[model samples]
Target: MKLSLFIFLAAAVLGPELCLATLHNITVKGELLCDNATVSNVKVELREHDTFDPDDTINAVHTDSSGRFEIFGEEDERKLTTFYLRIFHKCDATHPKVCTRATEYDVPEKKLDSVYDMGSISLNLQDNKELGRRYDRDSEECD
Candidate 1:
């Protein structure tokens, strides 16, 4: 019984490491745009379908003033088979709205031997007609 318990414990710890060894480092670059223009100060998040929870967020990055961002993660054939980009627009100084419009990149399963560089993903913000009308009303009220 003691020997069996030891073997189980060892496998539990080492099994994950062994499985993750097949993963390669991947870099994804992308740009966030709003109103047909590049948007700065946007938050970008990369989530894998195998682990879609917040705890499984493989990589998180922010776009620069030019709306350019790069996210780095372990490219695992088992984990990163399907991934999606979550873009958030900082509308206010303290609030960030989740831009539902996002770009999904489907990576080839068999091509995990090397680093996969997903070049430039473009994201467009969701058009909120209400917000536009509210802005117009607020401006009119202020004037």
Candidate 2:
């Protein structure tokens, strides 16, 4: 009974702090702009591929003074981890429109196996309707 009491006391003292291993580290880098002008100090959102709602974004990053950004996340032992990035910007303050990417970017499972680099994503901020195609090769939406 005394040994059990001692163990309980130790557990209470340690609290919930613990060290866990991180399996994979992923990095996605990109530049953001609206109508040929770089956008700075905007919140960049990273989300699991299936998360449709912006409020549930997993990670938030900010762009530099030059409108360049790098967002990263870690995964542990998951077979597949896909992510999508988005931003919120006003294309034209006088006009109202949606300013985010309509399609999500997919990171292959093999790449997520370790440290992965998604190089040079150039995103153009425009209305979804004006953007035309869903997966426009030129850019992604940021609204």
In candidate 1, which residue pairs get closer than 3 Å at backbone N, Cα or C atoms, i.e. clash?
none
What is the Å distance of residue 140 in model 1 from its true position?
28
TM-score of each: 0.53, 0.51
TM-score of 1: 0.53
Candidate 2 — which residues are off by over 4 angstroms? 1-22, 50-56, 77-79, 92-94, 97-104, 108-143
Instruction: Provide the lowest-lDDT 10-residue window in model 1.
Output: 128-137
Question: Which stretches of model 1 miss by more than 4 angstroms?
Answer: 1-21, 51-55, 75-80, 90-143
Candidate No. with top TM-score? 1
- 27-46, model 1: which lDDT tens digit per residue? 66756655557777666776
Q: Could you tell me how far off, in angstroms, the CA of residue 121 lies in candidate 1 after the best superposition?
A: 5.5
